[model samples]
Target: RRSVRHAYCQLCDEAFRSQDTLRMHLKGEHQDRYCDTCDQARLLPSSLFGSDYALKEHHVQSPRHAYCQYCDRHFRTHEVLRQHYREHYVQSPAHAYCQRCNMHFPSGAALFDHYRTMHY
Candidate 1:
């Protein structure tokens, strides 16, 4: 027989086959952090994801958000995402540049790769 893995929710005394389901359950009665507006939203049992803050962080970084909590903004384009570091955003001191857009890379290899993939 194959063993099954279960994630137990302490809030409702229920066990789930997937931790994702348990996380989904957090948006139920006890906590409202989960976005019901999201297409993935579904009804599931509740509780035990450590804390509401963790859930908030997870939601903020999820596909629905596409946000940078550090910058406190949502990036509409990949070019903006690549220039996330505020200092290197549109030319401050970073040497990397691809025609109007300024981006910062940790190494020369990354910069070259970006140029080849995006500019060339």
Candidate 2:
């Protein structure tokens, strides 16, 4: 029998086998201390409340951030908005819209069948 040891992240309580993996976890999961909207631009930790305020400001001002008034939701990209639309509105029985060819289906089953037959 072999016993394997894993390096665990104290901040997120997740385990990894390597220091590089742990470092990546810390950067991605725990360190939200940079503005993602600004292409991971570095911020000064000594400033007022660090980068959280900058991230919020960027989200508010950036045109890339899209807002859905109907759902009161925000998306980072238009592609994400399209995905949200398809998931929430188009996939619903009342409004079935085909994602592939931009066709409208009367029902979700019809859309699924169309995808299975035409797409698949």
Candidate 3:
């Protein structure tokens, strides 16, 4: 990579060996005239001209597609929305009698124990 000899500020015509030094000069010297954000100064030798600041601003301000009134949060999918709503309620697995042996149990654990003792 070639070193930058002298960078001239288009606004003030001041010259420096580095672009960082020029940016500082522009930020400090002409704060009222320059509209760019000075806090995030770029030092790399690439064009700052290609960045899209408006798109970033739009994404931050826009409302999300899925919104939950219960949790007061936004999700991107239906499964996520359903799972989030379940957090407020207690969930238990439904159980029934095993058709093969006519053994009855209210929960899976009880059914497994009954089957193991009676059949196996």
RMSD vs true structure, all candidates: 12.5, 13.3, 20.0
Error of 3 at 76 (Å): 24
**Preferred candidate (lDDT higher): 2 or 3:** 2
Best by lDDT: 2
**Candidate 2, 14-68: lDDT as tens digits:** 7887866766766787566533433343334553224545555555566767644
| Native-to-model Cα distance after best TM-score fit, residue 57 in candidate 3, in Å | 13
- Tell me which of candidates 1 and 2 scores higher on TM-score: 2
Q: Worst 10-residue stretch by lDDT in candidate 1?
A: 39-48
Off by over 4 Å in 3: 1-4, 38-120
RMSD of 3: 20.0
Residue pairs in collision within model 3? none
Model 1 Cα lDDT, one tens digit per residue, 34-94: 4443423323434323465555565575775555433335566546656674444334435
Rank ordering of all candidates by TM-score, starting from the highest: 2, 3, 1
TM-score of 2: 0.31
List clashing residue pairs in candidate 2: none
